[model samples]
Target: MAKRILVVEDNDLNRKLFCDVLKSQGYVVEPVGDGRVALESARSFVPDLIIMDIQLPNISGLDLIEAAKLDPALRPIPVLAVTAYAGKGDEERIRQAGAEGYLAKPVSIGPFMAAVKGLLAQVGAVAG
Candidate 1:
């Protein structure tokens, strides 16, 4: 089966871009526009990986990541944080918040897919 990916992004353009990219790569993509729906979708959709935007409405992606990590059922799923906040220590903060990886905003399709594939491969290895 194709791996499932949940994309939580508030911006319509970004969300659509990500969804299209992942879909082209044969991933089952579910895009949510707000953090509140993100949480619900994560629970129900059970994506193998999450690509989260930090500046989301309702709840910030960082907060959502933290919450997901704290939840035993959700903690194992890998999260790749995509943020425009490329400030100092931003990467570290994202990792500390339970994201397996971080990508700066305006991510290209190649790097985005590479990161997603890497995470999914890691998960596959662990599962196997």
Candidate 2:
């Protein structure tokens, strides 16, 4: 089966871009605009990977990643933070919050797709 990816981003253009790119790559993409909705949608879809914006409405992506890590069912799903916050220490903070990878915005397609493939490999590693 094609890997499933959940994309949580608030900006319309960003979400569309990410979703479109992943879809073109043959990933099943489910895009949500808010962190709260992301949580609910994640439970239902149980994606293999998540590409999330660190700043989100209702709840921050960091909070969402932390919450998912705490859940037994969701803990194995890898989350990659895609954000504008590429400031010093931001990558550390994202890792500390349990994100498997980080990508800063405006994301470069090549690196972004490479990161996605890497994170999907992680899921395969754990599952196998």
| Winning candidate number (TM-score) | 1
Per-residue lDDT tens digits for candidate 2, residues 26-100, read 999999987788878999998999888998877889999999999998888999999999999999999999998
Cα deviation of 17, candidate 1, in Å:
0.5
Could you tell me the lDDT of residue 92 within candidate 2?
99
**Global Cα lDDT for candidate 1:** 0.91
Q: On residues 16-80, what C-alpha lDDT tens digit does candidate 1 reach at each position?
A: 99999888878899999978888789999999999899988768789999999998878999999
Query: Which pairs clash in model 1?
Result: none
lDDT of each: 0.91, 0.92
RMSD of each: 0.7, 0.8
- When summed lDDT is taken over every stretch of 10 residues in candidate 1, the lowest stretch is 51-60
What TM-score fits each model? 0.97, 0.96
